[model samples]
Target: MTEPSTMLAIDPAAPGGPEVLVPVERPVPTPEPGEVLVRVRAAGVNRPDVLQRMGLYPMPPNAPTIMGLEIAGEIVAVGQGVARPEVGDKVCALLAGGGYAQYAAVPAGQCLPIPQGLSFVEAASLPETYFTVWSNLFERAFATEGDTVLVHGGTSGIGVTAILLAKAFGLRVIVTCGSDEKCAAARALGADVAINYNAGDFAELAREANGGRGVDVVLDMVGGDYVPKNIALLADEGRHVSIAFQRGPRADLDLSQVMRKRLILSGSMLRPRTVAYKSALADSLVRDVWPLFAQGKLRAIIDSTFPLADAAEAHRRMEAGEHVGKIVLEVP
Candidate 1:
């Protein structure tokens, strides 16, 4: 079969809103060494994509300008040194960019076989949230079995994955969602307690739910005022990992509390990491987390899907904050 010279992809023409995500024909990217060219079937939309469209998260040096971070598809071609994912392999990969396209050239190290019993749409939803949650909650926070974790934005994609993974790993999970309905959804996903932030104080509720010892770990996306509160809710030697700052980046924290509690505060950005680093993360996921999917202990929670050209509408839905889980784009 002849490969197409050009493919349709969503590009942010300028820094602005969802309207900026325009479809246009672009040259197909050729995989470099240790990479594979994927015929994208589905892509996951994430909060960072929104920030990138708004010019808040500028493309890293040498990264593609396309908006998607994760994609599920088939390997159509491979670059030199790519051994495992040969042509015709079905995979879902975490990408630095360029996933919002008909095809994407991704580092083979970032690719993983689509889990058994999952569709391309569900596979697409896994990489970004799963990688982030795994890197932060388990790796950085060092959360282990029997630990209790408080996850903010419990109904969001990252939160849902964190809840499921934490529960699967034998940790007690508490969550905070914006509404009562979202709180209920979190509980159904295995959260031991779900705090409706609009109805109650999340820090207090988390502490109360954890026997007044506070949680052993916190996955916080909301910064600003949430920073101090998150710090307040951590038990001694607790870890706090920040992935995104939906509220605001700036925070005035009480260092005294951090010092007294011996808390660990850390965060990571996935896109800029070296391929070797991401490859290691992929290995960890396949070895430790993939089995959970086959056992029916882990699953993707999709809120909605849009056709490739209607990416702007998908972005609108994500920004509206009504969706409970991930928003996906189907590529033809």
Candidate 2:
């Protein structure tokens, strides 16, 4: 079973639209020290991939230029200093980049074993959003049992994962969706409350849902004017974790609110973090969350999948905001 020297990938000719995500031939990455080469069966399509395609997302220094951030596949080769995940092990890994391809080289520690009975597509969908949600919503926000959280973009990958993780850990989650349909979807996924942002003021609705106390944590992706609104909804000593700013980066907020409430505002971009940090996160997920999946208490919710060559369509679906869960790309 010799690996191909070159693989089909979506490296992009230049920064542009979804059309730029065309498949092209690129040399398959060899596993570096402590890394493993995955024969990628599937890859997850993420917002950062779209940002990278448009040249909007800043590339981490010396990171791979390819447009994928997560992949699930089988280990075909291993690099020096690697142990445990030998050749032929199935894994899904959070990558620095280079996931939209037939093969990817990833640090062994970052490659989490696929949960029992999950397909490659399901496995692929886990890494990026799971890592992001666990780190920001659970770790950074310090959301514990019985706390309530306000999660924006209820149907988005990160939002869905937040809901599931919160439910698994006994947190009450209030999520904001763009439509009634999406809100219903979120409710079906165990969210304590789902508010359609277009319906009315989400902050008021979420506060009412939490018995007028507001949320202990806010997982915000929609930035800009929403920041102050989110801040207004926080309970005393609340934590706000920003994972994206789709609305815009700048925010006009009242500093007096921060002082009075002792709010903590924190944000993180997963790709820029060191391998050791991400690996530790992966380890944490394996220990704390993977068992839930294995026990059938949790499952990957996939909206759709595309062939590796149809990455453009995947991006378009993601951008359209019509999908309720993860959009994935399947490889040969």
Candidate 3:
């Protein structure tokens, strides 16, 4: 089969609002050694994409200027060293960049076979959020069954995945969302308690939900002022894993509480990690979490989808923060 010469891609002509994400035709990229060329079917929209569009999250050196981090597609061509994902295999990949196009050159190790019974749209939503949650919440924080976890942004892609996975693994989950509707959505997704952050203090509610001992783990995406509140919400020797700082990056915290409580504060950024590290994470996810999908214990929550040409509108919806779960862009 012959590959196309050009494909449509979303490019942020100038760093600004969603309207800047303009569609343009560009030459299809070739796979490098250890990579594969994917015929993209769907690409997941993430907060990082919004940050990238604002010029705050610059593309890593040597990555494509296009803005997408995860995609579900068919492998059309394989690079020399890649042998496992043969041509025609459908896969969802954790891409460092370039998933916004109709064709993407992705490292083979970052690709996972789409789980049984999952559509391309569902698979597309998996990589970025799952990888981040697994790497940080499970691996780094050492979260386990019988423990209590407090998740912020409960209706978000990452928060929802964390809630489902934590519940499936027998952990009690508490979440905070901005509205009552989102709070209800989080509860329906198996969160033990959902607090409307706008209505009340999440730290106090989380503690009450955990029987006054505070939670065993906290998955925080809202940083800044949330840092102090998150620290206050943790149990003795509890872990705080931050994946984003949508509120702001700077924080003023009291160290006395951290010391007395034996709290562990840590965070990670997924895009800049080495291929070997990400590949290992992919392997771990397949072995541990993929089976949960087959059993219906885990599922993707899609809020909306748009054609590739209307990616600008998709970004606008995401920026509004009114939608729950994941938003995706369909290649066709």
Candidate 4:
């Protein structure tokens, strides 16, 4: 099959605000070897996408750059040596870039069949949050049954996914959200305890909720002022993983608490990792987690969906922080 001359995509004119994300036309990308061309139906709006737009996160080196991390669509064409998925198979993929487009070229190995009973919009929400949780919480942090896990930003996409998955795996979950309403939502989604970060100190609250014993794992995206508190809130041999530093990256803190508790601290950025790592993650998700989604034991929590042309509005909503779950852009 031949690629089309042009397709619709959202482009950042300059690193600034939502207005910078303007619609543009670009030539459809062809699938390279071991890749497949997908007709994008929807793309998830994540904080990383907003960071990329605001210059906090720079775009990967290229021109006519399109920014989106996850998409759900149909495979339209396959490149050399591809097998398994045929034309028109519905799939959701983890992409490095170019997801905010009419068509995207995705590594074939990173594409997963859309789970039963999920729409394109829902499927679009899975890759970034689910992959992050699966990789960090379960895979790297060594979270397991009977472990007590604490997740910050409890109402956010990552928080919700982590809460649900941990509960499903028989781990007690404690979470911190910005407001009581958000905490309620987190509890409804399976968190055993939801602390209002605006009203309480999360470190102290998590400790209180766990019967004086701190949680086994703490998944934190908020850094800076919360770092010392996070270290203080861990159980013996606990794990602390950071995926983002929304507050600030730099911290001046004492390490005695970490050593005293025998805690493990780690952080990861998914985008810059080698393709092989992502491919392996995708395979692991398919093998270990897809069954939960297929059985309806896990589901995507979508807060809103915007038209592809309204990508600017989507960014505005995300930046405002009212959304409780994943936001998506319908690409059509």
TM-score of each: 0.98, 0.98, 0.99, 0.97
* Candidate 1 lDDT trough over 10 residues, lowest sum: 199-208
Backbone clash numbers for all candidates listed: 0, 0, 0, 0
- Could you give candidate 1's per-residue lDDT for residues 257-327 as a string of tens digits? 99999999999888888999999999999999999999999999999999999999999999999888899
Query: Model 4 off-target regions past 4 Å?
Result: 1-3, 61-64
RMSD in Å for all candidates: 0.9, 0.9, 0.8, 1.4
- The lowest-lDDT stretch of 10 consecutive residues in candidate 3 is 205-214
lDDT string for model 3 (49-92, tens) is: 99999999977789888889999999999999899899999999
Candidates' lDDT values, in order?
0.93, 0.93, 0.92, 0.89
Error of 3 at 293 (Å): 0.8
Q: What value of lDDT does candidate 3 attain over all alpha carbons? A: 0.92
* Backbone clash pairs in model 2 (N, Cα, C under 3 Å; residues 3+ apart or in different chains), count: 0
Per-residue C-alpha lDDT of model 2 across residues 1-332, encoded as one tens digit per residue: 99889999899878999988888999999888999999999999998888889999989887788889999999999999998699999999999899999999999999999999999999999999999999998899999998999999999999899999999999988999999999999999999899999999999888887887968999999999999999999989999889899999999989999999999999998888998999999999999999999777789999999999999999999999999999999998
Error of 3 at 199 (Å): 1.0
Winner on TM-score (1 vs 4) = 1
When 3 and 4 are scored with TM-score, the better candidate is 3
